[model samples]
Target chain A: MEDVLKIGGKEIKSRFFVGTGKFPDKAVVRDVLEASAAEVVTVAVRRVDPDSSDENILDHIPERCVLMTNTSGARDAAEAVRIARLAKAAGCGDWIKIEVINDNKYLLPDNKETIKAIEILAEEGFTVLPYMNPDLVDARRMVDAGAAAVMPLGSPIGSNRGFRTEEIVRIMVDEIKVPVIVDAGIGAPSEAARCMEIGADAVLVNTALSAAADPVKMAEAFSKAVEAGRSAYLAGIPERIEEASASSPLTGFLR
Target chain B: MTLKINGKEEILEKEMTLTGLIKDKGLNGRNIVIECNLEIVPRQTWGKVDVKDGDSIEIISFTGGG
Candidate 1:
């Protein structure tokens, strides 16, 4: 998996990036991270109130995982840029998960706004990973706009719907030059594995691990599944066919 | 008095309710769920749920998003 994912000019060791939120406690979060072995962890800036002293998830995450800050609350390009700068100022890191979700419910990124933000962020020299749907044309535009990587969702965020659009994702893997990280709506480990098997460089998980009865174990599960899937993909999966290929087109009349 | 939230101490002028705490901190309550002393703070009770001294408060906010 280390060789599989590269983003922000840095190589990530694992494909499954875990979120630090929703754990029972920091201890549990630590346990889950240790279990999942996620090299990169997705953490949002707005949640940690530095001044208040009551809300910081800083302790829960151990010293090992690389923190990937998010612009989860930003409504537009300007706001996303502002948040990115703030995150940099806050010493969060240069690698940012730019989520330009305007609507509140579905949390879907508005394509127009997200593109604008990605452009600005890229120009500012930030390693931008903009979350996008399974749209290859848009992904091409983003890659040209200087995005470090394009994170196309396998399904809706936290819906755990799995890779319902596997073909489009495969096309994305084929078309894009940068890493194709599958983000959101992953319900189970099998789904995560499937994404990795399909050639996703990495995947981000939150609700599934957070909401689980035992998050640490579940994190470990996601880790193993991703590794296994990646291994399977690398080892080469068997060809699929509706029926047997009887040397029709190329071999025309060999028989 | 110092209030224990996520294992940190904070001094406040008066007893704070979850809603007041949320508003004072300027956090988006919809994206976060608050728990005090291991009890889930219900939406209806968020406004009235009082915080006292030495309460082990935990507030979890979803960050990976949506």
Candidate 2:
């Protein structure tokens, strides 16, 4: 069977979604993307600095990757819609990650606003993926609003806290019709594996890679971890028992 | 004419098209999105559209983010 993630008529081979952010050198993005083999990559739209002539981030991204432009600065749905429109007008693509976050202290996404943005953008024929707090209600609302995927945060954005909402995310994986992408707060490959093991469709990573000592190697590790996790999920992870169960069996030990 | 470009006030010596302004500001040939007065002006129309006074133009491009 072909194991592929399909979103809005697009087939993605790699389940690892990478973000281009906080790299020591912008050039390292290419290497990280190559290592991760991430078919979906996230980017932000910002005003071009008139004073400095900096290289465009698009130049570094491979053409094969689907550019998922995130509305990071939007504090509300209207602003997010504007940013999404601008991103599409920029010729990046129609894929927009509706990230409406007003709470700057914890940087948590506002579910209400994200759903609104998804409603508008998805109506506009853009493939909407909403980054939201891990809540079953909000996830369903987003899906109803035509979101291609519902991205629930594991922890705070860029906190490197690892998977803190495993139970809720697992529930979402079981309930949500769209792909449940565990985005943000995934600090290690093990966490990514855990998310997949719980049946998450995919995981989006950034800080874990950019903040790592070796981003390229870390990207490769995450790639393998996501693959392993998906394979484990497909293979059906055994149910956990509270009491110890001998793998070798009690009667086979010459009893 | 004066325009608010990227939130900065810039005084143009003469009225110019969006393409002219982009060229004058050394922003041509780049993968950028132009928003004039809160409306996205497609790249094809940049040459035909004339930037007026008090126009809030935002030249945007892709950046690193998650």
Best TM-score among the predictions, by candidate number: 2
Chain B: TM-scores of all predictions: 0.82, 0.90
Model 2 lDDT tens row, A143-189: 99999999999999999999999999999999998999999999999
Summarize candidate 1's per-residue lDDT along A1-255 as a digit string, tens digits. Answer: 236466777777888888776565556777778898887887775534535534456566778777777888788888788667666654556887888887778777876777888888898888988888779999998888889998888777877777777899999988899998888888899998998898788888888898888887888899999999888888888889898776557655667
Angstrom error of the Cα, residue A55, model 2: value is 1.5
lDDT value, residue A33 of candidate 2: 96
Q: What residue pairs are clashing in model 1?
A: A158-A185, A160-A185, A160-A187
Off by over 4 Å in 2: A249-255
Position A23, candidate 2: lDDT? 87
Question: Docking quality tier of candidate 2?
Answer: high
Q: What are the chain A TM-scores for all the models, listed individually?
A: 0.89, 0.97
Clashing pairs in 2: none
DockQ of 2: 0.90
Tens-digit lDDT track of model 1 for B1-66: 578765677787887788888777776564455667756566678887888877777655533332
